[model samples]
Target chain A: MKKRCWRILAVVFWLLLWQTAAMAVNQRILLVSPLETLQALFSLLQTAAFYQSVAGSLLRILAGFFAGLVLGVGLAALAKIYMPLREMLFPVMSAVKATPVASFVILALIWIPSKNLSIFMAFLMVLPLIYSNFLEGLNRADAQLLEMAKVFRMSAFNRIRGIYWPAAFPYLLTAMRLSLGMCWKAGIAAEVIAQPKNSIGSALHRAKVFFSTPELFAWTLAIILLSVTLEKCMLHLVNRLGRGLENAR
Target chain B: MRVERLCKAFEGKPVLTDCSFSFPTGETTAVLGPSGRGKTTLVKLMLGLLRPDAGTIDPEGAKTFAAVFQEDRLMEHLSARKNLRLAVSTPDQQISEALTALGLPARDETPVSQYSGGMRRRVAIARAVLADADVLILDEPFKGLDPAAREVAANFILSHCPRAVRILVTHDGAEKSLMQVKNVLDLGMAKEA
Candidate 1:
């Protein structure tokens, strides 16, 4: 705990130096002091608009993430069962993976409303990763166990539960970890470009437009806090789910 | 029952050609053969897990079959008892009795992964035997155990279902004698290298 505190203190010390440098430069357009950023953050926290913006972005992004997870897993399952389906999915997954997030956001803007654009962008960012990882996992399931199940004439359900699920879980978990982060980053970027009403991105955009550097920094800090907290919560949920499965066994 | 004109090929290469045999009822038969000589294939064909390019498998009334694979194909997460229960709906008492006889002391709660190799082998054997089936196919069942453990397993098999049709596949001639195999189907002595 002491070592961790020291490391944190070192980070604070660097931020203080940055604050001093920004003040000495006296250029609010270029850089904002840590004190000003903190003051802006505290001031923003007192307003209902801040909460509304945070909540709006959170709901939309999470919606997209959930949708992607479901669709990706379903497609992966289909891809595993049918060769033609897998072949068909290959090019589509590649397209999604290869395309730039900004390109996707821009293209999506013409098709979807600005309010929903971030959600769609987040879905596009997450889908291919989940699908590819799950497909690879299903493909790499233990052949020996499968053969054994075959010899025993295990039911389809039993084979899936006993063999396929176990093999695919680790890969699925890894994909979830990676995809969640991507979704957040991409979703926020999409929101910033789309400038959706009642969103953190919109507030950030407003701050930038007004040259309120401290407000910008405050909102940026809020984004970082949300990202870190959400990632930790997701990891905790995944670990808890794993433990529950272990206990069920 | 008979396996008549049994022939199988992988890709372009043929493994068993025009192979014929009769597996007698109410008797234990050992299919003794060297590795890669279609012994496992023969077991699979009998179980209908594999198809023969040209052959007929005339199975008797024993449509239901239970098998101990060459590898102990067990659910790593589930306990020995749970694994057995999944395959067969036998009572806990019966499973316990069988497991104890096979020298698995802590039977019910320990997952197969936690068990040692010998213990896992015993669980697999117990699972196969406890399953309500007329035919039992064991593929190299006693590969990893010491002599004493093998004896215990053999005794458990003998006591559990004395009248079932047993097909034991192994490369060891000594295993044939140890299991008191009535008939030996030496696939090695059959035609083709």
Candidate 2:
């Protein structure tokens, strides 16, 4: 507890130094003080548009993440069982991995509306990472345990729950953590370029155009907060899943 | 059970060449040999886990299988009972009795990872015996058990599986005696070896 307090204090001290630097500069366009950013953030909180933007972006990005997760795991399982499927996906996986997120977003702009482009961008960023991680995990599964299961004639469901899940869990969790962060970053970047209405990205764009440094900092802080919160929640969920599996055994 | 004209080689080095044996049915036959004498490889052949270079493992009427490998092939996350349940459709009471007979009263709910070497061996034995298998293949099943614990665990096996064709592969000659086996196949002294 004391350590946590000291860490918090250290963060506060650094933040205060930032605030002092901004105040010494006395240039609102250049750097906004922490207090000014907080005030802007509080003001934005009162508007229904802020809430709607948060909800819309959160839902769309989360949808893409979940879709990618399902497809990635499913395809990986198939590929692990059949080498031909893995061979077929080689070029596609390489293309997805090599393509730039911004390029994909711009290219998608021609096919999709500005409102839904963030979802595609988030999905594109997340799918390959997850698929590759799951595939690696599957590849590295304990060969000895699989032999035991085979000799015992273990049912497919039991084999997955007992052998596959435990083996793949840590890798899957790491993949999920990486993909979640990427989705948020790429999703917001897409929104900024597309300039979707009522989004934090759009608000940040407007603030930049008008030189509202405090507003820009406030929107940035909001994104950071949302990202941190989402990460914490997902980690909590994965931990719970691990505990549930442990208890199940 | 018979394996005729069995021959296996790895990278041009023959391991078991022109080997043949008639394994007894509905009885325990302990195959004793030193390390690297194809004991484990033989078990793999019988179970079809590894394809023999040249041979057929004719089980005759065997359909299902249960094996305790040289390594304790346990799902570390699951309880012993769950592991047994995964193998067999045995009722809860039968599983409880089987575990108790093996001196594993608390094992039904305990994860196999927390078990000691002897306890894990017992669990592996219990799983193989209790599972729905026509034949039981035990590869160094008592590799880590102390003398007393081995006796108790062996007794559990001798009592539970009376009619199943049991093939015990081990380095211990004492283990063969404990199982009351009449035949001991020394793979190291096989004609081809």
Candidate 3:
């Protein structure tokens, strides 16, 4: 409770500072007050177009995230088992990590429709992080425990559930927390560039073009809120799944 | 089970050389030696966790093996019962009885991570005993137990694995008497029992 109060106070202080700055500037195009931003957000909330944009972006980005998660886990497991595959993926994952998001956005636009750009961008941003972290976790599993499993002749499924899952869960969680934020930022950036119809990025681009500073701030705030909420929900589900695996017979 | 001219080395240092032994079924064979005398290396070779530099271990007809390692290798995130469940699908009632007999809390939901060292050791012992393997290898299984708990664990192991080819590796001489072990393979001199 005390921490929450401090957080609220800190936010209010920043808002007051922003309001004072806007008043001193005396130019609506240059800066907007916190009140104006909130008002714009409220107005946006009342429109059906706002809902469609949010829903469309949310579905596409989440589809990309889930697809990346499955492929990342699968690829990591295969890499762990097969040395040639690990060697083959080393340069690919490194290239994905090193390349700038904007460069990928530009290159991808030529090959795919603008409607699918955000999904592709989000998936690309997420895959390498999940793969590397989960593989590291698998590498760190207790060797003694694995030997015990072998001597006991445990089935492959039981060995994975009992040994591998527990070791890899924390790494998987870390990857999810990081990639969730990255995917959102990159996905929205793609949307803005690609100008997908009925997307939050398109709305943000329109707000920018019209010099509607308040609307731009409101959309940015909405994206932050949505990203944080999605991250929290995903982490909760993963933690529950980890607990179930630990206690399973 | 018999080992024929077994030899093992680590980085050109011989740990065991030309060692041979036949472990009888339905009896306890204690592999007694001091520290750094290849007691663990011998067991690991038998469990197929390590490859011998030479010779072979024939299981005869023993199909399955279980072990209590030097460290308590129980899943730290699982309860004692759940750890046993990973090895065998024994019913809950029997699992609880085995845990209770070993002086662990049978119904407790606490993960083994929160257990005491002695409690964790007992959990490891219980896992091996309940694994129902034809060959049971115990490497210092009673390391962390109190005298009373050690006695209980010994009795539980003896009672549970009557027909197994029991191979015990330990430094404590008292465990031999407690488990009523008759066949002794003293590795310090590399001599046959």
Candidate 4:
């Protein structure tokens, strides 16, 4: 209760500071008060276009995130089973990690439609992190347990769910958290560059063009809220999966 | 089963050489050896985790397909039932019975990580006994248990895996008669070069 009260007070203090700054600027185009941004956000929420933009950006970004996750895990599994495969993937994964998201977004814009740029950018940014972390976890699996599995001739499916899944769960969760945050940030950056229809980045671009400072702030706030909510939802689901693996064969 | 002139070496240091042994089906063989006598290396060879440099291991009648290794290899964050569930396709009734005989928690929710050393050892024992295999290799499966508890675990293993070819690896020779293992192979006295 005390923490909650302090958080509320902190929010109020920031809003007051914003309102004072907006009043001193005396130009709605340059600075918008927190109250003005909040009002704009609520009003924008009533529009069909606003919902469409939010939904479209979310779907593309999430599609990219899931795609990257599947490919990363698949490649990591292959690498673990074959040393030559691991050596082959090292250079490519390192390049993906080293290259900036902007270069990929620009290159992707040239290759694909504007609507698909965010998806490609997001996947590129997340793949290396997922692959590396998951591989590290698999490498740390208990050798003795693996020997046990071998003696029993455990089927490949049971070996994964029974041994590898639990051993790799924590690493996978950490990767998910990191990749999820990166995916959203890169996805939005791609959107701003591509200016795709029905996207938060395009909406942000319009706000800047029309000198609607309050609308710009409102969109930024929406991005933060959506990013946080999605991250929390994903983490909860991963933890539930971990619990199931604890007892599952 | 026959180990004909089996030889194994790690990095030029010979652990075993020209060591021949035969284990018949439906009998027990107590492998008595001191530390560094390649008993574990021998077990690993049979499990196919290691290959003998020179020798033929003809697991003619019953290959050792199930084992309690030198280390308790139970998954730490799972309960006894959960651990056994992965290693065997045994029914719940038999699993519970095996755990009961070993004096372990049959269905407790506590993960093996939190259990004491003795408890974890018993869980590993239960998993090995319950595994659906013809040959059982027990390597210090009762290491952490007291004599009283060892008796319980030994009896359970003897009774449950009666039909399987049992190979017992322990420092205690008394366990031989306890499990009715009349055959003994002392690798400590075996030749190595």
Tens digits of lDDT, candidate 4, B73-168: 887777788788777888999988888788887778788889899988888888887885788898877788888988888888887777887888
Each model's total of backbone clashes: 0, 0, 0, 0
- Tens digits of per-residue lDDT, candidate 4, A145-177, equal 888999977778777877788777789899999
Clashes of 1: 0
Poorest lDDT segment (10 consecutive residues) of candidate 3 chain B: B184-193
Each prediction's RMSD to truth = 2.7, 1.9, 1.8, 2.7
* Model 1 lDDT at residue A67: 91
Residue pairs whose backbone atoms clash in candidate 4: none
DockQ of every candidate structure? 0.47, 0.73, 0.81, 0.68
Best by DockQ: 3
lDDT of each: 0.86, 0.84, 0.91, 0.86
Task: After the best TM-score superposition of candidate 4, give how far the Cα of residue B11 lies from its true spot, in angstroms.
Answer: 2.1
Q: 1 or 3: which has the higher lDDT?
A: 3
Interface RMSD in Å per candidate, to 1 decimal?
2.2, 1.5, 1.0, 1.2
What global local distance difference test value does model 4 have?
A: 0.86
- Model 3, residue pairs in steric clash: none
* Candidate 2 collision pairs: none
Q: Candidate 3: deviation at residue B109, Å? A: 1.7
Write down the worst ten-residue block by lDDT for model 2 chain A: A240-249
